[model samples]
Target: MNPVAVSIEDRVLALITEDELVSLTEALVAAGGENPGGTEEATVAVLEAFCLGAGLETLAEEAAPGRPNLTAVLRGGDRPGLLFLGHSDVVPAGEGWDRPPFEPYVRDGRLFGRGATDMKGGLAAVAVALKALKAAGVDLPGDITLACTVDEEDLGIGIRAYTRAHLGERFSGCVVAEPTDLGTVVGCRGDSYIDVTVHGRSAHSGRPADGLNAIDAAARIIALVREDHERLQQDQDALLGAGSWNVGLIEGGTGTSMVAGECRLSLDRRLMPDDNAARILESLRERIAEAGLERDGFAVSAAVTMEMPGFRTPEDHPLVADAVAALSDCGVASGIGGWTAACDGGFIARDFGVPTIVMGPGGLNDQAHQVNESVSIAELVAAARAYALLCLRHSSPA
Candidate 1:
């Protein structure tokens, strides 16, 4: 086993395997940090131990009371390093599971469990990739850093904290190890939440005309939102297409006997890089104002509650070419693709001006957050090899 005698690529390919990937993924799934009520502490602990054992310098920081973000570094050179980003928190496993969601198991070649696809599987691939790179004895000119954070499935507090804290540090590039089915995503649509509240006077059913109706105002706003969504289709990008909207939640009417005093609408907006959330909100507010809902003390107010910017990297960027090449070399044939789903990578790309791409092992639309959430064993191994290759190639220029 002469390190100098063997090629780095060969060594990395040999070291990463489906068994190892599964072992790590199963452990991560078993840790069970479902986002709504649960915390990422258990998942962070698992990642910390793995990072330490793989000879990486691990740093764990509490994002919230029990939620944590882990940054593990494979130290390389003086220059900015490559960032491999992921999240530890997963969406809560709701009803409709064939078995317990957190109990990881393999069936037919797929690892099934909550977060296995969206994305403890991706987490394991990231860890395995870093481990293989280290075990292969590759001397990266730039460091390869793995940052697994919390709250990606929720409001994105984990990534925001990481970006704010590392404002002083820079990176050559960022690879977000999200479930991208081993495809490299150059453009991804971002997400945002907006809430519209209407306040009015409640009155008895017999005297409804005497009071302002908030539910009436809310219905008008919903129609307006539909129109706005239609207007957005005209402004489209080649990669990400058009931004869209959905009224995901609505709360109104206290009882059938009284006119509703208040109504609230929670909106989900998918954004492209060109769409400015503030401007969109302002425009929406203007339109709502014109609706004249505030006659006799009924008024509607809307504001953006959460936002993650979307990014589109030019297909000609070196980062895109490099990622495609790495996956191709690993026998995962994929090219530059677009992700309609949003991810934390947008924060890194928009805020830090880093070249970022989302790539990993599972299917986004089908597997992630589904009842039988699962990821292919072979895909996980390929993702690891591709990630290792990307790290090696990324560090070469620096």
Candidate 2:
């Protein structure tokens, strides 16, 4: 490692102060008001407010009427840039909590709130690290881009639009600040959402035999999918493991005394490198055919609603080596591993073809999306140091 690079890393770690981290967290929790996924207008408003307060240039892209995604840039020297990606939206705060969902609370050295562990904590930590680096007069050799987008908990329209309209060929690498238990995540499984609809005739329940039931056809289709899931496990790929399928939602008959006229099943499929949307649709069609549901009376149609492909950076990639060395300087010992859950890293890696990694504070099973979701301050501080070190190691002049 270069001496100057090591020195920069050490300085960044030292500069990540406790007050800075606390302020960032406070701003995040204050801004991340009530509302989850689809209803994140207030949250976006708070994020924009925080950005303006920090004197950072804020750019908002309207994904919908009131829903907007935010992007802010922390200027640095001329070099290859790094993007810090995070999502402002979080899952719904279900029942059972000591405090309200929107009201941020700190207790027992941990921050308790809805978005604390799943993502907001990580985002706050990144903000604090950048603030410290700027204050310390350490001119980064590269730029730091911070993007906190909406619709990550439901649909990723924010990232999709951003990548399509902007950032087409700008960034060098990206780090999705998702909760990875302070571990480095190098790759993730691909994901696709499909809606399968089966059509049949409707008749009076008294004469059920007079009409073909779409519900029964849907049942057959579900069975075929279960079998397909097993086969997918057998044909698992090396990096992504087994391609799995889950029937998320099913809708059928309307009236209690009527035979079902239509049935629609929503499927969530985790794909491997070898699997694509078209191939998965074809497989579903083949399964329907094998189940003898290809006739006119029983028709099956598939529509792909969303897709995010899996991605991996080679172990020898420069970005990977740099990240590992930075973590080692922070006294962390570990190698990168695959993540079971998907994030915007898929978009960065697959769409932009950028070397992306998912790394941050908090554990994987800290009751994310639960009533009492929380993140330890120690973990938050450690993550801030790690991210600061990462910037130093990657941005120092050679």
Best-performing candidate as measured by TM-score:
1
Off by over 4 Å in 1: 1-6, 395-398
- TM-scores across all candidates? 0.96, 0.92
Error of 1 at 103 (Å): 1.0
Q: Which residue pairs in candidate 1 collide?
A: none
lDDT of 1 by residue, 1-398 (tens): 35653477888889998888999999999999888764789989998999899999998887777787899999887777789889998888999999999899999999999999888988899889888888877887777888888898888889898988887777888888898888889989999999999999899989999777888888888999999899988887778888999999999989999999999999999998877788889988888878877654777788898999998787888888888988898788886789888999898898878888888999898999899899999999888888887877764244
Q: Scored by CA lDDT, what does every candidate get?
A: 0.87, 0.77
* Top candidate by lDDT: 1
What's every prediction's RMSD, in angstroms? Answer: 2.1, 2.4
Q: Write the per-residue lDDT of candidate 2 for residues 150-208, one digit (tens) a residue.
A: 77777678788778767554666888888887777888887889999988889999999
Error of 2 at 30 (Å): 3.8
Provide the global lDDT of candidate 1 against the true structure. Answer: 0.87
